[model samples]
Target: MLKLAVAPVPYHWPRARILSFYADLAKAPCEILYLGETVCAKRRALTPQDWLDLAETLRAAGKEVLLSSLSLIEAASEVSTQRRLCAGSEFLIEANDLGAVTRLRGREFVAGPGINLYNPRFLTRLHALGMRRWIVPIELSRQGLETMQAHCPVDVETEVIGWGRLPLAHSARCFTARVQGLAKDECALSCADHPDGLVLYTQNEQPFLCLNGVQVQSALSHCLIDAVETLQQLGIHSLRLIPQSEGFDAVLRTFDQVRRGATTASSAVEALGRLAPTGLCNGYFHGISGMDWVAPPQVPQGQASLDAPAPRKQ
Candidate 1:
């Protein structure tokens, strides 16, 4: 059976909201819960101890927990924090960067999505360094994964972003801070105001992307409700669902039902619209433009433009 893991929160949620979110998740069908901040280090709504405390709580509920590290190591203090996260033995560490990988060489760890493991040889090296599983990057298409999976190093598991707004890029510059005309160091933590993320639009008023501190995500939510069978055929081990502000619990139930053949993909997609902030896209999974959605067996390519407006439920 394919396991479902809830990926770490990518947005700057309030501390109380974060606690409340997991409290609900403690009974969700998700088998694994990725705990900790993998985005900006400045979003300190939950400290290290707080994350560990949450992890302990989830584990007591029989959920497997993993701690994720920031994708970018910006400063010395961030590196030190990464070191501390890797030093712990209670939970699996999702290594999003080389620094985390270096610290977790001897320990069984998960290679997170941000770590660019493109080829089998590179993945093999990570496997040698105790990478038990690897979260396939958001850009890799179905064909790309099939090729890579054929040559997967020993005992390594594969996971993909099943649904949610795709995290497209990260930068050293704090976009939310810059938007406020404030310096990175002196700017107030403004990302918390937009729990989902600060939306970005083009001059034509077309929604293009979202700015969550240093991370820029695609405006179109990347969904794979229709790809569950393909995943099973490919020997994929897990599906990772990134946390969103609303409708996530329902999303979990829908995906589980779809995976089990209890619901049609069309029905699940109907329910999915209520969960995604924008209309869905799976183009990158089809070897097309990442902004498009391509259904299998020669279903006509549907181009989901960057200006795709958030969908409303009927």
Candidate 2:
């Protein structure tokens, strides 16, 4: 069976809300939980100790807890956090950048989606360095995965960013701070105001992208709820769900049902439309544009269910 894991939160949110959110997640159906500040280092809502404590709590609850490092490391403080996270003997670490991978030498670790592992040679080198698992980068197509999966060592598990807003790019400059007319150094941690990231609209008012401090993501949430069968066929061992502000638990349940063969993919798509912040897309899986959703086999035939309202247009 395909396992479910929740990716670490990408946006900077209040500490109280962060705690409450994870508290709810500890009881959810997710088998694995990737926790830590993987985005801007200045978020400061949780200290390293806070993450360690949360990891222990989740581990006690029978969840496989993995600590993730930042994607864009710009300073000594950020490197220090990475060292501290990797040096720990308690939890497995997910290296989001090459620096983290360098520190994780000789130890089993997870290569996060930020690290570009596109070809067979890349996976082989990482496997030799003790990479026990690798999360497919969001841009890699399904065919791309098929060509690389066979090259991976048998013990190394394969996972994908199965759901959530696609994290497109990261930079040294904080776009969110720039938007607020503040320099990166003097910005007053303003990203907290927009819990789901500030949507960047095109001049004509079409949703184009999102600004999250140093990370720029697609405005449309990248959803693969309709790709369960393809994911299974591709031999993906786990599916990663990036946490969002609303309907997250329901999102997990719907994916869980589809993976278990309890319902059809179209039903899962409809269920996910009700649960996600935006419409679902499986384009990357189908070798199309990342925003396009190619219908899956077994789409439900009846009218949409009344349990949740249709997703609002952005």
lDDT (CA) for every model shown? 0.85, 0.83
- Model 2 residue runs over 4 Å out of place are 297-314
Q: Which stretches of model 1 miss by more than 4 angstroms?
A: 295-314
lDDT of 1 at 304: 34
Q: Score every model by TM-score.
A: 0.94, 0.94
Residues 1-314, model 1: lDDT tens digits: 77888999999898999999999999988898998889888889998999999999999999999899999997999999999989975799998998898998788999999999888899888888899999998878999999999999659999988988889999999898899998989768888888888878889865678899899998778888889888988999999998889889999999899888998876677578667886777889888888876543333346333333355421
Span of ten consecutive residues with least summed lDDT in model 1: 305-314
Q: Spell out the clash pairs found in candidate 1.
A: none
